[model samples]
Target: METFNLFHDATDVGPDGSEPEGYLCRAARLGPKLGASRLGMSVYDLPPGEAICPYHFEWTDEEWLVVVTGRPTLRTPEGEHRLEPGDVACFPAGPDGAHYVRNDDEAPARVAMVSTKNEFGIAEYPDSDKVGVWAGDAHYMLRRSGHLDYWEGER
Candidate 1:
């Protein structure tokens, strides 16, 4: 088993430049082996009006959030809901799982996020029709029209 202290690894930078004020703690990351690894977990501390994730969906992985401290507004296609401590939200693999967490309370909000790592996750900025894939240090755009097309028959 591995152990980590959030205070020792937290950062005010968002992996893809979502928010400059929120802090994230990456509990785990890639190991020596290849293929899909677990990104252990993340704790996002967002002050009022900040959010996690830029309203996107994953193509190959799932994510879950657990409210650890203050309340946050969970924005989903179904609408928005205020989640308080002990509340848990899950974004299963698929279009319906698209969601983001925004701190709406006056106090700082904290949530724990767990997801699989190193997989190609197709994220779509719905209103912008801008699709991106988290591949290493950068996010590559997949034109809106080509959001789902892919090689079918094996060569």
Candidate 2:
């Protein structure tokens, strides 16, 4: 068994030093570091006007987000809504689950994201016309229009 404070264990720096532009603060993936293999968990500290991630949805995984502090805007298929502290949102798999979070308040927002961890998964980015394929720890991104035929070059 393992236990730790979410706020205390979280850091402002992500696994890498940087993230997508327009985002402020840092994100930390805690599940892997904590020996959690069946689920994925991450904490994000977002400054005002900063987004936690791009709008996207998974084909093989379901996800949920908990608002730890501050009110953040949740963008979903139904449209955007403000999430207050202690609020929880569920994102089902597939297109209807596509979502993103942004801190539009004056204060910074802290959120905990939890998801099922699958050995293989596919994520689609509607706004970017791109798709992400994940196998084990490897990830590949491709443009939707660049997909090749299934039997291309088959002998």
Candidate 3:
């Protein structure tokens, strides 16, 4: 068994958020804490009108977000969702789960993001519907909504 005290000294301030533009404080997986696997838990500080990442969703990995402060507008393929503190959101792996978190407030928004690395996971963007396959370097788009057929077509 292994135990870590992130509150004590495992605070990991991630690389300045530029691609997405935000500040991330990694509370877990800050050190050599994994054993042949990958998992991450981070607290992201998203300034007003800023996004945590590109408008994308995972196909094999599921992600969960817990709002700790301020409100955010969740952009998904389905539509937009406003999230407040204590609001818990989840994105399952699939084309229907295309989503991203954006801070809509003028104040800084903070949320805890939990993610797990899967052997077979792909992330897809909805606005462009661009799909990024994990463990591989390839991206594509679907012609129809909620349509994801791996190894069934060629791009």
* lDDT score at residue 124, model 3, on the 0-100 scale: 63
Model 2 steric clash pairs: none
Q: Judge candidate 1 at residue 19 and give its lDDT.
A: 32
| lDDT for residue 143 in candidate 1, whole number 0-100 | 66
* TM-score of predicted structure 2: 0.90
Per-model TM against the reference = 0.71, 0.90, 0.66
Predicted candidate 1 versus true structure: per-residue lDDT over 98-152, tens digit per residue: 8878887899777777776654567767866778887667778866776444666
lDDT of candidates 1 onward, in order: 0.69, 0.87, 0.67
List runs of model 2 lying over 4 Å from the truth: 15-18
lDDT of 2 by residue, 1-155 (tens): 66647656766465354666667668777786789989998888888888977899999999999998899999999999999989999999999999999998999889999999988999999999999998977989999889799999999
Over the stretch 15-119, how does candidate 3's per-residue lDDT look in tens digits?
554443342323344224544267656666666776777777776777888888789888777789998988898877776666788887878777777777665
Give residue 4's error in model 3 in angstroms.
Answer: 8.6
TM-score of 3: 0.66
Q: Candidate 1 — which pairs collide?
A: none
List RMSD in Å for every model shown. Answer: 5.3, 1.8, 5.4
lDDT of 2 at 105: 96
Which ten residues in a row are the worst by lDDT in model 3? 23-32
